[model samples]
Target: MKVIHVGVGGFGKQWVRVLRSSRKVRVVALVDVSEPALAAAREAGGYNGRVPCFTSLQEALRAVPADALVCSTPPDFHREQVVAALRAGLHAVSEKPMANTLADCKAMLRAARETGNTYVVSQNYRYRPEMWTIAELVRKGGIGAIGQVRIDFHKGVAFGGFRAEMEYPLLIDMSIHHFDLIRFVTGLDPVSVQGTAWNPAWSHYKGDCSSSVVFELSNGCRVVYDASWCAQGDYCDWNGNWQIEGTKGTILYRNGEIRLLKVGPRYKVESSETMAPKPPPADSQHFVLADFMRAVKNGRRPKTDVYDNIKSVAMVFAAVKAVKTGRKVAVLDKDSR
Candidate 1:
């Protein structure tokens, strides 16, 4: 497959490298608003200054034909870019959040449905071995019916960009990964969200760097989350420390380890097992890329297709609403997917 990659800088730089490494696709064209970034990505992407670079996706599409369009642009630009790519009959891939708002997300999904083009949001965090193990375990009844979930995430990041300007930096920029991972592992749709987002006086960013939210899942599971992007110490994994409790037992992942606890009477831990994650060899973008390729080949919707991923993005928007209004907000309002 031939690919046209847009926004080849920062995180896009990593996307360029992943694209170069994947044998399933060839980078035919690169697009970026920054000439310097295009040059840098050209080198880092191992295109050897040979692939054509354009200032816009439209310009690239006008000049070259490609099987897919991979966009690493900000969420603000995703709707327009992705809709155009899908309308042009090319499979579209995008970095997370889908779009800035639920309406825009729905528009992108509508375009895909109308065009019959594949639209995949790269929720790469779900492709990890540990995530797959958790999902498989939950699916196979290893944990029985989930009842409660606890997640804590802490990270000290100073990305001197738009992130600093977001009102809920930790919730909007980082929480999507955890929110999507929860939905992926548990196969539970979020029903409602109630949360608070705050910023510590010690924080450097102009936005709230910490958040606490409780998501009511479809199965009445309560997912309690506490996260901080400007944390000073005791940083957790980027995927967060997860403890999902169910009727049978609890499955937990912390410090890069997966463990299962089998419960007995009165929630007594009868036995414990350190599980070795059994997933495909590829991970993160590598694994997502492979899945996208197979879905394209089979003419099926990819795992994180826009139809499904919008729900996860809705979790973020709903949390933001809950924070702004100080009230519980439905993850999916009267308008159902």
Candidate 2:
């Protein structure tokens, strides 16, 4: 599959590297507003031959004939770029939050439906090896009938630039990963949420620095989330921690280890196990790109397609609304139109 990458930022550069490493994908073009970013990505991407670079999406589209596009641009530009790609009859993989607003997400979904092209929102946390292993355990009833989950992501936003200036800040920019992960692990949709947010320290950021939320899932399970962009002291190595409590047991993951605490007829105890840190065979970016390529070849939808991502997008909007209103918001019914 011939692929064109839009937005050569830090994440965009990673996309180029991953796609280039994949045997199924060829990097046909790179687009970015900054010439320096383009040059840097070209170097890191290791494109020995001449690789087309463009300053504008239109120019890149004109220059590259691609089967699919990866939209790694800023959140605000996601809708426009995705619609453009779908209109051109190319499948699109986008960085999350899928768009700046619920309306924009809906529009992008509509465009994909109208164009009959795949629109995937790249929520990579679901693809993380440790997270995937935990998900499998949950599905196999290792922790039987999950009742509650807690996801916490606390880290200082070191990447200071346009991302810091965005209006929605942390929730829109980062929380989608956690929201998506909860759904991915439990295989449940959120029904409602209550949230609170504040920007106490990072005065430069237009959006909230910290947010706490609680979600009621459709299957009577509950999820609690805490996301922050300001961690004062030494940052945690992985930037987050997760815990799930089930009727029969509890599962927790932190610092690359997973523990299962189960209570049975014999005794109740904490059985802890650490996952060996095995780096991806190549890189995770390569895995996602390769998965997308195989899906395209076999006429299958990638794991993170538009319809599958709506729950995650809905969770984000629900949290934003809950923070603003200081009241619980129903996610699937109240937030989604």
Positional deviation of 68 in candidate 2, in angstroms? 1.1
For candidate 2, write residues 252-330 as lDDT tens digits: 8886677877766554664655555444343455656666777878889888788778778988988999999999888
Give all TM-scores, in the order shown: 0.96, 0.92
Candidate 1 residues 10-82, lDDT tens each? 8998888899888788999999999999989988987876899999899888899999999999878999999
- Number of the top lDDT candidate: 1
List residue ranges in candidate 1 displaced over 4 A: 334-336
| TM accuracy, model 2 | 0.92
The C-alpha local distance difference test score for the whole of candidate 1 amounts to 0.89
Stretches > 4 Å off in candidate 2 = 237-239, 265-267, 273-283, 333-337
